[model samples]
Target: MTWKTKVNSALEGITGYTIVRPRPQAPPPKDTPRPPADPKIDRLLRAPVFVLSPVRSGSTLLRVMLNSHSRIHAPHELHIRRIAVSLTTEPVRQAMDALGHSPSDIEHVLWDRMLHRELVASGKDIIVDKTPSNVFAHRRISTCWPDARFIFLMRHPASIAGSWHEADPQERPMEEAVRHTLQYMRYLQEARRRYDGLDLRYEALVDDPEGEMRRVCTYLGIGYEPGMIEYGRHDHGEFVKGIGDWRDKIRSGRVQRGRPLPAPEDVPEDLREVATAWGYLQES
Candidate 1:
């Protein structure tokens, strides 16, 4: 069986799995309200969150909020964590050993060596690797660290398209947006397929900032502090400046230009389904 299948098989043994592909149906109307917590769900107190979602999809916004919490110190999108985990995990280590490397060499070449080098290079801890592509490897990641928490950030496709167009006018905006949304969608689906009882929270953080942040922290097993709601007001330049010169970009916009593209109302009808699946009110 393929590694993915094996992982899926292993996950089947666990109960209370929640795979959210295509985003959970727009939580009943605002008043209907979904249950905030389930007894079966394991509380992940202060567990590091691997914020996985598409780029330009409010990821930075979510990261900044978590960073604002006194207990959290999230850096910008540092992809090296997944790489570190992949190279150091026991199964991966065994594969390397089978390929003929001394234990000392493997230890030096794998975990301690590269991770320490990168951590020092960046100078951060309580690290959060916020990469959209990380979702692509969620199965491996969940298998590697079963208790790890995930928060998937989603944005309306039209807004995602607009943001992409604003960032670089070269690409076909609509196409890029659809492609981006689908990539994360498939990852969410696959993660559910592979990890039976994975603890993941998916939110359209841009839509309901306060409510989502509360649920996100709850899933992370952290208390809901008011500070998390105003992270955008803080100066996150220390870690924010590193990703795509985003600090400069955020400074350029006249309006409140947070990471997530605003909900799109101008999206063409043909493409409205994409936004709907992405968890946004349909554009008429």
Candidate 2:
């Protein structure tokens, strides 16, 4: 690579550059003082909301509905928890040093700054990041932003355990499915207990998006708009890449609620207590 190319690639972690035209020999135009950036936007580091859940828990559906709102910029799966975790370590600092950037500079350029740009593009001020696996990273997020709010999206453990590749789990080992469900339950239980957030059930959301989203908007201190029901009218841009099951449903512009859950036996005995605690029945 040429020296310029090498330099650009090495500094790619830095913020994007802007170009300006040279002023001609004529006197420069009178300099008008620039307006101060909005204080709320300037300090919008903490996410307004995170739809934290496990796979197939209807997070995409909820995101589409919320994104349709005029003031909420709910985006697709960013998987930022992993990035959030990495940013808190020494390696991220070392990489920033190599790129001639500071820790906050690199982090701002990558995460909060990018989200703010997207939020502005969407003509919204609130950012709602929906990454299903973020349930496991609640502590990390809380540590970074003590006021981080979450929409703890959940489905019945048996329903999630029974779903994989859109396939019926009857042919697979039930133990493996139950194991995965148990882990998510543990995380959800802990997150619900530890954080300052809302617990929203996927079944309830899909059942009545209008009512659920109205409550959600009220919780987030935003007024509800009718446009949220027309989520399919918007282009979320690869919002369903890793979550294909939701693509058609989101595009259809209609709420698709979950079916009757599998028998209680589908959930492992150990997880029954969690299910009950979360308001799902323990019986088959």
- The Cα local distance difference test for each model comes to 0.54, 0.69
In candidate 2, what are the lDDT values of residues 152-230, reduced to their tens digit?
A: 8888877777664245555556677677667777897899888778889988887887898889988999899978877
TM-score of each: 0.57, 0.71
Candidate 1 wrongly placed segments (more than 4 Å): 1-47, 81-127, 171-173, 192-208, 232-235, 239-274, 281-284
lDDT of 1: 0.54
**Structure candidate 2, residue pairs in collision:** 264-284
lDDT of model 1 at residue 76? Answer: 61
The TM-score, computed over Cα atoms with residue i paired to residue i, of candidate 1 is 0.57
lDDT of 1 at 118: 43
Q: How close is candidate 2 to the true structure, as a TM-score?
A: 0.71
| True lDDT of residue 91, candidate 1 | 74
